[model samples]
Target: MNIVVCIKQVPDSTQVKVDPKTGTLIRAGVPSILNPYDHYALERALEIKAKTGAKITVLSMGPAQAIAVIRLALALGADRGILLSDRAFAGSDTWATSYALAQAIKKIGPADLIICGQMAIDGDTAQTGPGIAYHLDIPQITFCTEVDSDGTKVLVKKLIDGGHQMMEASLPALITTTMPHDYKAKYPSFLAAFHAQDKQTETWTAADVNADLAKLGLEGSPTRVGRIFPPPAREKGEIYSGSPAELATKIVEILKKENLIK
Candidate 1:
């Protein structure tokens, strides 16, 4: 089986900074890390590779600097890395971004399975994976917590509100994984790191992927960011200090005063 894993390079929340003028992230100086959710997807992909001896490819779309995340995937056990970077792909929302990625995967040719994280930290929209599946015209399973293989078919345990549902899909499908999908990701050894650093990743631009110029970047995005600002600060809590009965009366009084309870 040939497995394609999609990953993203996101700003480390601890070091995030915004561009005041553009109302966008200032990615140049911020420390970048692999999206935490993507790690579980990568781990699951590697586990599948280990069990079936399948070839694994890591794919990502971002600025040129995003290559670091791809190399990290290589160090973790991916056989190859593909970086989709270009001026045309800048400022793409989830829909356009997934469109571009789907084009790149088409350029990479056939694959048995595609894997991705449940969502990206930066956007957290959880739309890209399904968007890619839509673009690829393939069946998809989202929020998968467990995956099993029966040689020809893939069985996935999907997480729902109360429990998990098991479903089987044929090969050449896309899957988005969530927490505890597999064992914790392993640390890369020195040798793997060194080799990953030396590896030459395939780089593709919008043109290389045959993406339409009009539908490749911000131009293709239907949604626009009207404003970007931090959320309002939370108000201090009111504490009721007394016996249970008194506290209950005080809570009710406060709730009634706020018109929250009848």
Candidate 2:
């Protein structure tokens, strides 16, 4: 079975700050790490590989620096890594990004399964996975916390409103995973990391993927970010101290004065 895991490198949110004047992220001096959700997804793929002996290929679309996360995936047991990097892919929104990745997957040959994180931390837009599924015209299961496969079909435990949903999808399908609350990510040993440097890793461009120029980058993006800013600080709650009856009256008066009640 050939399985492709999509991963990303993202800035450490805790160390990131917004440029108030520019309404953009201040990336200078900020450290980057593999997106935690994607890390979990890679781990899930590795587990499936252990069970089925599936060949795992990690894929990412970002700047050349993004190869760090792909190499990390290799160290954790992915067979190979593919990085889709190009100037044409710059300023791509979720839709365009999905288009580019879908094209790359085709170039990678037939894949039995594709795994992705529920969302990237920097964007928090859980749309790319579904978009890729759409572009590939394949079935998809999202928000899964666990995944297992037998080389023909995939069984997953999906998170829903208040509980989990067990689901199954045939081969050549896509899945986006969400890590469990208690989940702890894994790192490779020094030896493993050292050996990962010898693994096969390739850098592909838009031209290599045969992507339609009209369907990539900012030109293909339908959504535009107006601006980004931190939410206003929350106001302190008003304190009330009185007898039960007095408190009831006070609440009624306040609600009425605030036009919250008739």
Candidate 3:
């Protein structure tokens, strides 16, 4: 079975800042790391591989520096890594990025399953995974917390509004996963990291992947960033000291005064 795990290199959210004038990220000096959600997705792929002996390939699209994340995936036991980098792919929105990724996937050969994070930390659009499925015309399941496959069909536990749902999809499907809040990402050992250096890793360009130039980069993006600014500071809450009964009555009175209740 061939499993393709889509991962991304993202700016550390805590250190990221927006350029007030350009409404763009100030990535000049901020450290970049693998997106945590993608890391979880990769781990899930590894789990599936351990049981099924599936060949796992980690894919990413970014600048040359982005290969760091690919190597990290290699160190974690992925079979191979592919990096899609080109100036033409710059400024791509989720739609364009998905288009390019879908094209690259096709070039990589048949994929039995594709796994991705529920959303990227930088964009948080949660659209790319489904977009790739759309581009490939394959079934997809999103918001999955747990995933398993037997080389023929995929079984997943997906999170829903008030509970969870069990879903199954046939081969050649895609899934986007979300990890628990307390999940800790695993690190590769020194030996694994050294061994990863010898693994098969290749860098491909837009032309190499046969991606449609017209559907890549800013030109292909239908949406534009108007502006970016910090959210307004939150107001402090009122504090009161009283018995439980008194507090309940006080809350009722306040709600009534505020017209929040009749």
Candidate 4:
């Protein structure tokens, strides 16, 4: 089975810094890590491969630096890596991103199953995966907590409000994952990391993927960032200490004073 997983390189949230002047992430000094949800998606693919012997190809789109995440994928067990990077792809929003990736996936040949994280940590927009499915004109399942597939059919445990649901889709479909809380990401051994360098990675440009220039970058993005700012600081809570009866009276008075109770 040909399995494709889309992963991303994201700023390590703990060390993220924002540029005051531009209202942009300061990625230069901040450390980069594989998006944790992507890691879990990749791990899920590996788990399936363990039994089905699927050939996993890890694909990503970003600057040249994003290859780190691809190499990490190879070191973990993906058979190959495909990096889509070029000047034209810079400053792309989710719409343009999904367009470019859909084009690239077309170039990667037929895929039995495609996996992606439910949302990116930095953007928190869960739109890209569905966008890919739309661009590819394929069926998709989102917010899956667990996934399994035979060579022909894919099954998933999807998370929904108040409960979970089990669903199945045919081959050549896409699924986005929301990993379990106890999920742990895998890192390669030193030797495996070194050998991962030898694994084949094909780098493609916006043109190589046949992405329309009109739909490649900021020009293609309909959404604009009006302004970026941090959230307001939280206020401190009040405290009351006294006997139970006194505290009850105090609470009642405070509530009445606020017109919350009478």
- Give lDDT tens digits, candidate 2, residues 1-262: 9999999889997776789888877767789999999999999999988988999999999999999998999999999899999999988999999999999999999999999999999999999999999999999999999999999999999999989999998889999999989999999999999999999799999999999988888899999888988777689999999999999999999999999998
TM for every model, in the order presented, reads 0.87, 0.88, 0.89, 0.89
Candidate 4 per-residue lDDT, tens place, 146-179, comes to 9999989999999999999999999889999998
Residue 164 shift from truth in candidate 3, angstroms: 0.5
**TM-score, candidate number 3:** 0.89
**Candidate 4 regions with alpha-carbon error over 4 angstroms:** 233-262
> What local distance difference test score does each model get?
0.87, 0.94, 0.95, 0.92
Summed over model 3, clashes come to 0
Q: lDDT, candidate 4, residue 23?
A: 88
RMSD of every candidate to native, in Å, equals: 2.8, 3.4, 2.8, 2.5
**Runs off by more than 4 Å, candidate 3:** 232-262
Q: How well is each residue in 116-158 modelled by candidate 1, as lDDT tens digits?
A: 9999988789999999999999999999987765447788999
Query: How does model 2 score by TM-score?
Result: 0.88
Q: For candidate 3, lDDT tens digit of each residue in 29-77?
A: 8999999999999999999999999999999999999999999999999
lDDT, ranked from best to worst = 3, 2, 4, 1
